[model samples]
Target: MIQRLLIIFIYFTGVSNSTAGQGQATLVVTGSVHGQLDPCG
Candidate 1:
């Protein structure tokens, strides 16, 4: 469905933005993991 695709797009965009930081790769990974888990928990 269109809604599902839109959600996926937005989720990836957020992930991309979060991972674009400099000198903080671990923070990015931690943020992405938390983002994915906290929503379902």
Candidate 2:
């Protein structure tokens, strides 16, 4: 749903913004999300 779309969006942006020498960028996903996430903040 929303979460999957978010990840795909981030991935494309990261790929487009990667450096010449960098093969790919890494995203650090740090949080306490379990079941449903509250993104109203």
Residue by residue across 1-41, what tens digits does model 1's lDDT show? 45654565566666667756433644545565666667673
The C-alpha lDDT values of all candidates are 0.57, 0.49
State the lDDT of candidate 2 residue by residue for 1-41, as single tens digits.
57765885576566657675234333322232322255653
**What's the true lDDT of residue 22 in model 2?**
36
Name the candidate that leads on lDDT: 1
Reference-based TM-score of each model: 0.43, 0.40
**Strongest candidate by TM-score:** 1
- Candidate 2: worst-modelled 10 consecutive residues by lDDT: 27-36
Residue 38 lDDT in candidate 2: 53
